[model samples]
Every structure is written in C-alpha cells, then in structure tokens.
Target: MSLRMATDADVPAIAALMRASVRAIFPRFYDAEQTAGAEIHIAHLDRAMVDDGTYYVHEDGGEVVACGGWSRRARLYTGSGDRDDDARLLDPATEPARVRAMFVRGDHTRRGLGRAILEASERAAGAEGFTRLVLMATLPGVPLYTAFGFAEVRRVDVTLPDGIVLAGVEMERPVTAGRTRCPPGRP
Candidate 1:
C-alpha cells in the first residue's frame, strides 16, 4: 500500500498493528511470558509516536498497515543497538538519530512493507540532518534490517518491568554517508 506520516486518526489501527507485529514476530525468539509481556508493552507505549515527532505509517484503505519512527537520542542510549560497538563507538555529535519501534501487521508480512518503512525512516533521518540511524531488531527483524545495510553493533537480552526477558539485535545504517544505499525489495 501507500506509506505516509502517521496522523491522529491512524492511532488505533497503528496500536493494533504494533501489538500484532510484536506478538507474532517476538515468538520466534522468545517464550510465552516474553511474548505476552512484549505484546502488553506494545499496547502500553502510546506516547512513543506522540511528541517524539517522527512517527510514520503505511495506510491502505484508510487503515494503518505498518508503522515505524525515529527520534533524536543521546548517543549513549542503550536500547537500540549492540552495546559493545554501538555504545562504545558512538559519539552524540556524530550519530544523532535513532530509529525505533517498527511494526508491520501480521497479515501484511512478506510484502516488503518492512523494507519500505526502513527506507522511509532513513530518508526522514537524512532530511533531519542525521547521518547515522540506529535501530533494535527482534530476531526475525534482524534479517530484514541486515538486508537493508544495517550492520549489527550488538545483541541484548532486555528484561521488562515485569521480569520478562526479550532479546534483540542492535544495528546501525549510515543513510547520509552514502553507505546505506540499498533499494527496497518491491512494491
């Protein structure tokens, strides 16, 4: 379908798509509690797309089928990438944008929506004067990000507030440096 900036009207469908995406994608790398925790967490984090100012969505027939976002983050932030290289290798003056919270609805899988969201996010980052963009990828999402030229910086097992553990890969792509110049799969 068609990608666009997320608006207030798409919020509910975006939330449902986020939950379904996490519930479906996280299971390949985690267990029942972890999956449930992540699903619940997805439903809880509404403001991520709010004041953050860079939320985006792909809508079809007025329904949000995909969503993702990027925000200005401190280079020292640890949630989105491999800690060893990402945290240690980053300088706030250098990499100013981090892409987070990407979700594609379950029914829309394998349709290149993931790739589209990523490229769009990268373009947004570049437009914002950010050269490097970082993201945290669930196990299944790792390959998709990898295929888009995001190099792994680290892997982490994060414990939620409820003590449920979920693992993800941290990756970085240099969108403005001409290093991350891959094309989307297809429309």
Candidate 2:
C-alpha cells in the first residue's frame, strides 16, 4: 500500500470508504439507530483538514483502502457543531494536536492500516512540536486507538442533527519522540 497526503480529488472516495467502514464495523458495538447516526454524522470528510494538508489516504493497487489524519486547528472533531474558534490555530506546547477522522475498508482491516495512519499522524504532530494527541473515537475505533497507546479520558455522546445520540470515547496519548509501537503490556 502507498501512503500519501490526500488531495481535493480524493474527498468523495474517502467519504464513501468512511461510510462503508462504519456500516460494516459499527453494528458490533452500536445499535441499528446509533449505527445509522454514526454513518451520517461521524463518517464525513473534514474539508478543513484537507485544506490544511493534514489528512492522508492509504491506497493499494491505486484504490484508497484507509484514510485518516491529524489537525492543528482548534476543532476537535467533525459533527461537533461549529464554533467561532474552530479555525483557530492550536498552541502545540499547550494544546494537543487533534487526531481526526480515521477509517479503514472492512475488507482491508487488521493489516495494520489504522496503525500506519496513527504512526504517520503521530510523527507529523510530533515534528510540529505537539506534545500530545487527542481524538473522539467512535465505538468501533476504540480498540484500535487503545492499542495505539491512547488512554480513554471519558465516554461521550454526540447528538446528531436528527437528535440521535452517538456514543464515543475521548482518548489521548502523549507524543513520545520516536515511539512507533506500544510497549509490551502497556495500554
């Protein structure tokens, strides 16, 4: 697989992959309604991430198999409602870089695609002097984030536009220099 920065032309395909990943994986952890809500609210592309050049796509045979990225902006995640300061720059020393939308094709999972994205994100954020990374993870993504050294801060419920509440976990991890893999027995 080839990993590279995402361009505007890749938005539509990345979005489709995200929705498909959610539909295939969320059912195991969420109810039908929640899954649908996540597909609508969580499975989306953040154009700001694209514009900022923070998003990435992993392709195999020239097809996008995985996608994700980190953000230095104040916005934590998509579907969280717009804020006046969403576009504000983060202070890397005091604010953790946001690990935004992450998804993998159902047929291409467990091949380390998610980990690869996280590693790329961590490296990029670390290079920018971010001391930590944070994300609001859908239920289906918690295990992957946890295995990547992220610790859960709390459980949260994000209400979609239609008032459907989608449960998620708020997770964070320190940006340890040169740390590629989680240490044995560490959560």
Query: Largest lDDT belongs to which candidate?
Result: 2
Give stretches of model 2 more than 4 Å off: 181-187
- Tens-digit lDDT string for candidate 2 (1-187): 9999999999989999999998998899889998888888889898999999899999999899899999999989887577899899999989999999999999998999889889989999999999999999988888899889899999998888778888889999999897765857865
Cα displacement (angstroms), candidate 1, residue 145, comes to: 0.5
How close is every model to the real structure, measured as TM-score?
Answer: 0.80, 0.95
- Candidate 1, residues 166-187: lDDT per residue as tens digits? 7777788777543346646733
Residue 184 Cα positional deviation in candidate 1, in Å, after optimal superposition: 15
- Supply every candidate's count of residue pairs whose N, Cα or C atoms clash at under 3 angstroms: 3, 0
Deviation in Å, model 2, residue 72 alpha carbon: 0.2
